[model samples]
Target: MSTAQPDEGTDRATPDALLHTRTGTEVTPEDVVLAAGRDVTPKNLEWAKRKIETEGVAALDKLLP
Candidate 1:
């Protein structure tokens, strides 16, 4: 039996972007609280703000990586 391989140089079609996609990379306090599995209450938001201020970039890096 013989088999054929796909063309390596062929260009594949890229999928269209979602209709309601977020365009910004800006991370908000809500993102932190939500990522930590906590409710988005006023106190939690305040804590997130302080965490961001103290940790600086580490806050987002910790959540993502």
Candidate 2:
């Protein structure tokens, strides 16, 4: 995952707006949820976590690539 520093004139930096990979593509929490095959909701993070734990980083190949 990547971190973003707020640009000039921005009020705040949002983690959800940061890119999660080196390609510089922006990703939202909703993108993460959908990537993990779940609904666009906060609870989907849990599903993503479980998938990672069970399948390893390779599980995210489709999403990240």
Candidate 3:
């Protein structure tokens, strides 16, 4: 599996970092990683969290695009 590596300095993010507690309908980072046959890593999780924070739920789209 191709796992992404985080650049130095940023705090490592958990796989569930991007998850929304109020809305129980979003696909989690773990699920996305599993479905893509990739390993979960702090960097990937961080990226996911960053995207969500910067782009709302639409981050999922840019995260791939």
Scored by CA lDDT, what does every candidate get? Answer: 0.72, 0.60, 0.57
Output the number of the lDDT-best candidate: 1
Model 1 CA deviation exceeding 4 Å by range? 1-24
Question: Which prediction has the highest TM-score against the true structure?
Answer: 1
Candidate with better lDDT, 1 vs 2? 1
Q: Candidates sorted by lDDT, descending order?
A: 1, 2, 3
TM-score to true structure, per model: 0.55, 0.37, 0.39
Q: Candidate 3 lDDT, tens digit per residue, 1-65?
A: 99998878778655665754334467566544444456789777765566566766554443342
Model 1 scores worst on lDDT over the 10 consecutive residues at 14-23
Q: Which stretches of candidate 3 lie above 4 Å from their native place?
A: 1-24, 31-38, 62-65
1 or 3: which has the higher TM-score?
A: 1
Candidate 1, clashing residue pairs? none
**Backbone steric clashes in candidate 2, count:** 0
Q: Write down the TM-score for model 2.
A: 0.37
RMSD (Å) of each candidate, 1 decimal: 8.2, 13.1, 16.0
Order the candidates by TM-score, highest first — what do you get? 1, 3, 2
Return whichever of 2 and 3 wins on TM-score.
Answer: 3
Among all windows of 10 consecutive residues in model 2, the one with the lowest summed lDDT is: 19-28
Tens-place lDDT digits, model 1, residues 1-65: 88988899667665543332223566678877876789999999998899888986457557652
Q: Which prediction has more favorable TM-score, 1 or 2?
A: 1
